[model samples]
Target: MVKCRALKRLKDAPPSTPSKKQAILQHYMCVSPTAKQSLKRQSPSLSEKVLENMKGFIHETKQKRNSDARNAMHVISASVSGEKISKGEKSKAARKLGLQPRRLSGGQRIRTSVLRSEKSCYEFTKRKTRSDITSDETKKQAYDFWISPTVSHTSSNKTDVKRSRIGPNEYVSHQIHLLEKTQTEVFLDFKAKYPDFKISQRLFESYKPFFVMPVKQKHRNTCCCRQHIEVRILFKKCMEFRKNLHASNLDLTQENLPVFEHLNDICAETVCDKTALHAQCLNRSCKECGVEKLSFNDNELDTSRNARDIKWDKFEYTEINVKGRKTRTKLMLVSKKTKPGEMFNHFKSLLETFPAHQNRANWQSEQY
Candidate 1:
């Protein structure tokens, strides 16, 4: 009724009559106690001209409030879409906008009024079941691919073997195989091979055989040959020398330091055929294969210790008397200054002595 009265007064007022405008304003103040109170609360210093344009001012204020609300809604939508805001932030925004938050089936609570607005509606998609996503044949194919001998080689270590129970009093032993690539790498390779088949990383990992293990440092054979060991030691020494040079503010290039590649080149040039194993080449006394030494300047190389004379302490199982009882214990065995050739010959002699018996015993043990 107040709005109607105000509009009726506005229409009846003359286009350029001060008396007419004054009459309309007086009518509004007399009829609407709220408008009179609002006008009174305004600054007393407000001029008559400002009062004349009060309607326009109120309209502008309403428009600004609406514009602010719209902008806030847009900001909230952008944040929600980009996943920049947390649930708490969404709740706080909703509360500020006088909107109630609603909880979804997934336990996520959000402002339905903001997220599910006409401009941008939040959509929820039903997750596909395993059977729906992948057919049985596809799963079987994936399993077969994962368990293939070529993809993952069987571990030679007996400790790595695993046994699984199939039924009551029934069990099956599997020779554990180590995967050549990481789980992610394997999945990528599988995807490359079967582009049509869609599988997530988690799903691919689940499909991996329990017997198939990832390659780790512990899984590697730490034992290296004498030549390789010497090379490793040489590399360490070179690294230390380089570090020392760096500490002393001296420029040390590759030419100043000995590298494994140089030693490898020497071996390639003087040793047996490249196809032959390093151990085999070193063992054979062929005219073509012989030991080659790398010569370095006295200043460049550390001659404090001789590499050839370095001996390794080995642990051997020895019978010891403990409280008059014979018990086998590992004792540190110090090696004599025996050449590789002499050691090889000594072992060859021992093997020859027990060759027939050893072969028979090994055959019997394998059968069991």
Candidate 2:
């Protein structure tokens, strides 16, 4: 009725000169909202029903916005969370809250199956489930990024087998520097990506899974081990075994311990790998297995616990003769979760918003 009355007033305007009347019509066309959009005013009851529907639509929109606001959460298994939540309890809670689209995605959805054998490395080659990654260009780029063809080398040809396995001293020092650069770059990128960090006495609360692959001393380096133990045992006599081991990262002075001749005879290759010795990484690519053992000990090198442990590098497994029953296992430890840095998640939401091919394709790329 208000719109009708307003329209009537405009239509029933007083007479005016021809030019003035023409100006008034033009101004009214520019200003009158009803003139531009026809309004077939509804009956009162029908209008009430329409208003009720609009209220429902607005309520639904508000609810969806509230639900979406909590897209990411600090969640874990009940056991890990220290809460006894059964499947039923979770389902009941979900129902009570009217939660929609309650499904896990990305690496979190990866099944918790152990990769325990060398042959199992093939399983990790590509995480794509179906024919989503058909674009040859995309495939080529991903392959190149993951498996770059680069060969590591040493400048001097020290023909001695023992010294060859243990790199030259100059090279080791250079390697330590390289390690520093790699670790700093990667972690800085990680920190930038995940700005939300909470620190406590015993734990680091992060949105992404964080692991510091410990700097391992070569259990096999008799030269390193002998000199290290002598200097540590002599200087840090009060320190515990692990503390002495950890302290080796700081102590660089080569003590004038007796030049134990035939050190090779003492530190034989066989004795280098004692199962109890926390020297070498189980992963074969570990520079410890090579001469670059000191590099990983400090947070300087590319010390990603997951990077060294990637399944692709010369995958090997121990043939554990467990009770005379042979069990072959391939093992790989990877980041359990990943948080994209800053603006990346804005792009991430473009995929997560829909349940279509583009969304799934984006999911695969981000997860990779």
Candidate 3:
């Protein structure tokens, strides 16, 4: 009875405030169906107002939710149709629709033309093997070229330094052959000769025989003529001095001017007709290819020191008494103040002193 009086007082108030209307709606919602009917009977106008406000609020909320869904759908459709939609906008739409950002759309596949162009631009060299070179004739040709006498020469000391067994009770002793030119130079020469031949540098190197090897410094003869050595050194120094003078804009006398400047032009024109070693040009005998002289400057040859005074050493086999037995052993023979010319004269004097029969066998047996 007390609640009924309070409700009556609220309804009889002068004007219906929002707070009063909200309280009345809350009360209607909390009451049972039978209680609601009783309340409606007591205040029919207040029940009608509460029902109308609830219906309008529900309608507006449903329209807003539907409009958000439509906008999200439009954004997704635009992205799929190739329209310019940024990832941020797409993610925003996805969030409005309550979906993961990445899951909003499927990724587009790359174009076939683009993939082809990428494949064409990217290059990789395939490794080559002996099997790739299937021509036996080509291999034979390369082998022949490498083993030619002009390209390489057999060592004079033919005693088998290395021996390898190929079969039972059979052995092969290969003679060492020294290469005149480097392997790379030989390959370049071969390529020049056979332009059609296709070969890699590695493959060309593999074709070299096991016995053939590069010449070492120790194998080279160091006993060069002193006169020739001095001439070469003088010429090199003159060339350098001439270059420095020319760079500094200094004038050179007629005698100091280069004499063989025209040699390069002459050789370029007649090189094809010349021999392999250019013997005619070197001999200065051929009318078409001879050179009279080659002088860099009018520098006099320095001849104050005796050529015989130059001390040098050479590797030679010397007969030595080992355990009272004469054994030939390799030794570095050092000659003091004795030039090659004097040594040759001494050898001739020894031959003249000994008889012809004794000279042939015993002369070489001497330690000196």
Candidate 4:
């Protein structure tokens, strides 16, 4: 009776200052019948507790996964192998669990490509097994291999010089030596021997000091016949005379010129040949009217005799002493002061200027 009287007093109070009992009554009236039944069956705090429990369960699963010895694949394999599960079973499990399997995407493919390229580069630059490292023989072998025309080639397809045990600087020096040697040695032979070197005629050209040659086979063994022997003797004599002249410290004079007559013959024979005369040859001659007229000659030779009309150019002439009389004689400026190597190159240049041919009459109209 007392509690009922208190409720009546609370409801009878002014609306502006409504009591807590009046608010509770209004909330109960506004709610549906189902919400009323749920409120009675379950406590409001119980739902928050259930949510907290679920969160803790998820956290425990994550920790278990992190603590596993191997990967998910291992776990999946063990699970499937024990139950004889197939792909269909796995997919059904995934669907039932509302879980999506991890998969690689386009971004993954790009990343994998980058990773593979980096791995290859690392493998290429990594150290390898070498039994003969830091040995004198190894270094020497490396040097020889580096300088050899045969071994120098593409960086991709490197020769087996890693075992040679030489330093990078030493290898570079070996390369320099090889380049220098190419100028002297026959190019075709050099290329044949060092096919990997990738040394081209155009590369030799970049270095002005070296002479470039065509890539073709040449006779390895030349004849040492009487004519060859005589020519060789003449060349030796000329070289000897030039050395003697240089050693003499003598001034320019006609008396010293006659000894070089044989040398002049050699020079003329070299210059008027098909090679020298045809290369950059104007093929012009001085006519009676004092005008230079174009002339052409067949690249022919009379090898039957020691000397013949080369007809390409006049023999070099300079004032010389013969029996105490000054007269025009062949000049020998080529051998006067040049080194042996330089002399050989100069002569060779003359020889290769024109093409070679057999004996013929008026063959200028046709190509050799």
Candidate 5:
């Protein structure tokens, strides 16, 4: 009877003020469903407890994926042995249990490409067994195996080094030099063209040690003859082991110009050459009047003489002695310099025109 009377009095209140009943009940049972009426209206269905839990799970999953990617990245540094696939086992297991699989999309393809490139880099190296041979004597014995007269290729693929003296006809090459540049453009292009070889430039200035001629065959047990020397070079050519090119433009006098021959001043010297790669891009076939071609001939060298591949970037010159009597030899890159790296800019006012090197009269005269 008392509960029925209380419900009747609560229900008998104005229809608009149902909140009063909620306030009364909130004073008792703190977990009353109506206690969250305002919160429920603002955020329907998903309760605060469920939303907090979901947020924590998402944060944890993200951290785990980052950890996985970091660990996978390590595999790229070491030699691939096909053994790393098992490391993904845990990932496979977790994915099977309804956990969202970590999908890399476009990023994964990039990582895969990097791995393929690293593996293809060692295709040219000749693989050898550790127990096969030893020192200089054994090395010569091994050479005889291929140079043996009976071998069909002995007439073609013969190579003669220092060990043999009178086996056949052999010539000697000497002197070697190294030149390098600081510009990244030439190096970058060369690297892109030949990624497998060592990215090094060895500029040979003097009589460089290119190769030797072959003499005798293995059956004779002595070095090959001069007739065989030509054979050795042919073999080297076919193998493409030589560093330089067989034919390249050679113009060495373009650096130091003839400025009033008696003045002993080299204002400038220009070099010209014909090359397709350096031609203008207006039309791939159009080679004439191409600004793309360098003003100097730094590239396309003679492979027969063994000169390091040249792609001169900039032609450097600095007044060496006092009175600026002579200019010094400088380096150049295949590409031009940056604005900050340029030699000079006249339109922006002379860099040293502020009453420094040039007197007021000279500076004014030049300005006018």
Candidate 6:
């Protein structure tokens, strides 16, 4: 296995950060002379492993200390209202709070609301899930917007106008046009010139035509907008295909993706029933009594601890022919939890199970 590079401790960390070996050597001074001699006496090569482990432990300790200091400083600063917070202090506080001081939105560094407590942040995030984009009616509107070749100003029907408080204005039209032609920075610059256009990001989603695909860093922001729309439509079709397949009780032998077989199956002792309502129960409902709880399952416990080790770059995608005159669809590659590093060709024989043209035809038939 490839080893991870050692993290530098804050004390030894410099403007020009020292290498792993240099950092380890610098930290060796903290070890008592007797302890160092004992490590050398155990085995000449053993000291290297001991030093490596020590380096990791020291780095973690430094990080914890820094975090504690930040939290204490924040609580003190927030409670003392008279103390003037400078730009530098404000930026530091924002970093500590896991917030952006100014986010680039609609072409400006607009200040976002700061939440004082974790409970407030959680509540704010929970409210965002109720966005109109997730509503079935809004999804139908989005589908209509997707099918239209050009964004015209003719969508003034009651359904379209009633969805958003601020209906389609000239500024919104201009913003959508900018999204089609330029990057986010250019769109923001355009909005800056028009002070009256005070549209929020949420408002943009309400007007279906104003939907802009985010430029992802994975593609270095060079993702083809046309292809992005095609893939998105394909994903929607895949969801429909999966639902129909499951409803029909059809076996998924050909389309089966790699998964943790053990994790998918419930433990024999775990079974929730009417009895669970009044008693300490098994079958996963009661964490204290459930047989399948992480405390009782060692494998699951270990997997949960190491799950975050999966790297973002390891994520893979492929195109497979799924329907209609060799029309292809994108599939995200997921690793089996049991054997995370094991590679297998699972999609080589999967067939086109859904009629793609049927959905496309339905969209085309709609009058916008």
Which candidate comes out best when scored by TM-score?
A: 1
- How well does candidate 3 match the true structure in TM-score terms? 0.26
Per-residue C-alpha lDDT of model 1 across residues 97-154, encoded as one tens digit per residue: 3334431111222333433332221011112245446665566666667767657876
Better of 3 and 6 by lDDT: 3
Q: Rank the candidates by lDDT, best first.
A: 1, 3, 4, 6, 5, 2
Q: Which stretches of candidate 4 lie over 4 Å from their true place?
A: 1-140, 146-223, 234-258, 261-265, 269-368
Error at 174, model 4, angstroms: 19
Better of 2 and 6 by lDDT: 6
Q: How high is the CA lDDT of each candidate model? A: 0.49, 0.30, 0.48, 0.36, 0.31, 0.34
TM-score for each candidate, following the candidate numbering: 0.30, 0.16, 0.26, 0.18, 0.14, 0.16
Better of 1 and 3 by lDDT: 1
Model 1 score (lDDT): 0.49
> Which candidate number would show the highest lDDT if scored against the true structure?
1
Distance (Å) between predicted and true CA of 11, model 3? 99
**Rank list by TM-score:** 1, 3, 4, 6, 2, 5
Give all candidate RMSDs, comma-separated: 24.3, 28.3, 34.0, 34.0, 27.1, 25.8
Worst 10-residue stretch by lDDT in candidate 5? 262-271
Better of 2 and 4 by TM-score: 4
Over 1-368, each residue of candidate 6 has an lDDT whose tens digit, in order, gives: 12333343534455454586576765775567976776668744786576555445434443455777555434433332122545556665445433344411211211112222223322322334443335444444333443234432232122222111122321111112112223334335434644454544444344333323332222122223333334333334333433544555555432341122221122222334433232234212355434322121122123344532322112346666765858555655434333212211111011111112222333443432
Q: Candidate 4: global Cα-lDDT? A: 0.36
Off by over 4 Å in 2: 1-119, 128-225, 232-236, 240-368
Off by over 4 Å in 1: 1-132, 148-151, 157-252, 259-280, 284-291, 296-368
